[model samples]
Target: MVVLVPVTSVNWREVTRVRAAEHQRRWVADVTYYLCLSAYDGLWRSCAVQDEDSATVGHVMWAVDPEDDSHWIGGLVIDAAHQGKGFGRATVLALMTLWEHEEPSLSGTPYAQAALSVAPDNRGALGLYRSLGFVETGELSDDEVVLRRGRPAQAPLRGSG
Candidate 1:
């Protein structure tokens, strides 16, 4: 069992240390980079993916594209040592489930759509995202493939019924 815990609640030093070596290509450079991004919008919520033991085995974040108003998954990193243990898949599934039903908001307004970018050669990530209903858009970011999933359907407004 994995859970996404608020970043502030975890030992961030350890979370950022969940990194692969310089020779090993990884999605995120370090968690500290993301923590620095906190200088900006509330659109981004940094979270640690904790295992049943409550150990921080991975990291994930959801940020709204301020320009397009679409929500995107960013900085998903599972420690290489913990890779292949299903942490990535499980955490990702939980993340999608969270955003899909939660009616994501940015600056107090509804934020929708789903997007993520994966490097073309990153088969592991492609496979995982594909399994979770993400598809390539043929759009590239610094050579990374952009994928999108529709936001989960929102429940009806209470009084609008």
Candidate 2:
């Protein structure tokens, strides 16, 4: 019942309208996230979450940190009403698939890995990240607990010489 839609294909006003107690201001959330990441000159991509009825229910953001060949996933949010319906797990799997197999392009930037951070007190989030193989990096940004997930680039198979 949940799927990812390009942010461009949806209306920001509707996405952030707080149509129900479960909804929140996505536009403002993105704006705030961007401000904090202003120091990074990387490519940012956002996807909107759609419900069975195609209503905007949540949002996710990920980007490439070209400086380090590292990718980042953030802003993984779901509506309060939709909180325990497996949407969160689905959204995350969708993101991992996006980064691992899709090879998202941004002009000429290349990324070989990805990372994320979550609030330490958010046990659900911590468990989710760990279940997906993410581990604590002992790194903190502001009050967030940073975690990383990815593998070293694989060498190309050499022709049988």
**Weakest ten-residue segment in model 1 by summed lDDT:** 103-112
- Which segments of model 1 are wrong by more than 4 Å? 21-23, 39-43, 105-111, 152-161
lDDT of 1 by residue, 1-161 (tens): 79988687436776777775354455556767776665365567877888999988987887777788667788888887888789988987777667655654423436456789998888878988998889898898787999998765678998996
Cα-based RMSD of the predictions, in order? 3.5, 4.9
How many steric overlaps does candidate 1 have?
0
Write the residue-wise lDDT of candidate 2 on 41-152 in tens digits: 3466667777789887776777766567677887777767777787778877777666666674642445456688887777778998898888899999678898887754
Residue pairs with backbone atoms closer than 3 Å in model 1 (clashes): none
Per-prediction TM-score to the true structure, in the order listed: 0.80, 0.72
True-structure lDDT of candidate 1: 0.76
Cα distance off (Å), candidate 1, residue 122: 1.1
Quick one: RMSD of model 2? 4.9
